[model samples]
Target: MTLIRSLAAALLLACALPASADIFKCTDPISGKVTYTNTKIGEKGCTLLSKDQNVSAVPANGAKKPAASPTDFPKVDNSTQRARDNDRRKILETELASEERALESAKKELAEQESMRSGGERNFSRVQERVKPFQDQVELHERNVEAIRAEIAKLR
Candidate 1:
């Protein structure tokens, strides 16, 4: 309910509405809603009402235009969005490098655990940590790569 009023108010404000031009008499047709500029349906577009006529008048052009969608906005090339992706890629790469280092260290630790630790210690803990963090890094890198490719594709 509030959304409808907000849309109406936005249209009125866009048209520089009068205080009295606040009523709307709308009816639905097979094609769509036929919005009247005044109480009468003769006007084609938004027709200004005199003060007396406008006291209880429904605003014309207060309805949002049909076919108004986000896609109607201007388009941009992949290079523009690619810049953002590149920034993200740099960060992802840095994280991936750190993860790789950690993973390598973990693998070595697990290997040494077989020789250095009590026989009861299986050394599986280090390797378990290895799999999760490295897997996460690989997934992050894969997603970043896919996003960069998509941005490039958009430019073509």
Candidate 2:
């Protein structure tokens, strides 16, 4: 019984303490832009803005007041949310498929270009000129594939 009382007292004391946060203000000299952060300012030109403490009053009965609900907030039903998520997934999958096909085509074209380089174009500059466009196409397709995959991964 004594341990339970002591624990309850400790919890009440913790709840009664005010919450405090340290705020730091930083300014960029060149851009004249100001930024605030919760961390201490380690830069030479930054300043400690303020320490803010939030205190809430406890009722005499020691009960919390009921929160008022806002009527104007928009809400979506679970079915609607699921439908939107399904549509998003379908779009992302379609894009991924298209990107994958483009990547395969680019790889095939690059291989073809590699095989077509003749012994007549033995000069290094001629060889580079012939290979550069194919290499660029392959790189572009690879980047597209990666970007599509990332988008698909981000969807719910």
Candidate 3:
């Protein structure tokens, strides 16, 4: 059953590749596991699966060169581009300031929740459950602040 599966795999692999490849079936002497490959093995257990004459071609480098910009492409004026960059920086700075304020508010709210004690929440797990939402809110705001600061930094 395993030999049939190995032969099926070899046939599928041979079909997938170009007809030039000479498929080989090899069996491990120690493990008795059957394997198939295109490359010829020096071991005694390897046998040629395909009898047709093999003529393999080495493929050339496939990396593509970048295309040149067309002559008719729209060009932005330096002053206009500078104005756009300045507007973007101002927007990002405003967002960063807003996020910082939210982060501070979240921290304060989290602190308030942490300071409050409840008679019903006697267990430590109950206390943790009560504070979890506040903690999540604080974490979310902190992440937002960091992301906003990163965006502001990228403007430079």
Whole-structure CA lDDT of model 1: 0.56
Best by TM-score: 3
Cα lDDT for residue 7, model 2? 100
Cα lDDT computed for each candidate against the true fold: 0.56, 0.78, 0.79
State candidate 3's TM-score: 0.56
Q: In lDDT terms, which candidate is top?
A: 3
- Tens-digit lDDT string for candidate 3 (33-53): 887767776668899988654
Q: Which stretches of candidate 3 lie over 4 Å from their true place?
A: 1-71
Q: Against the hidden true structure, what lDDT does model 2 obtain?
A: 0.78
Candidate number with the higher lDDT (1 or 3): 3
Which of the two candidates, 2 or 3, achieves a greater lDDT against the reference?
3
Candidate 2 contains a number of clashing pairs equal to 0
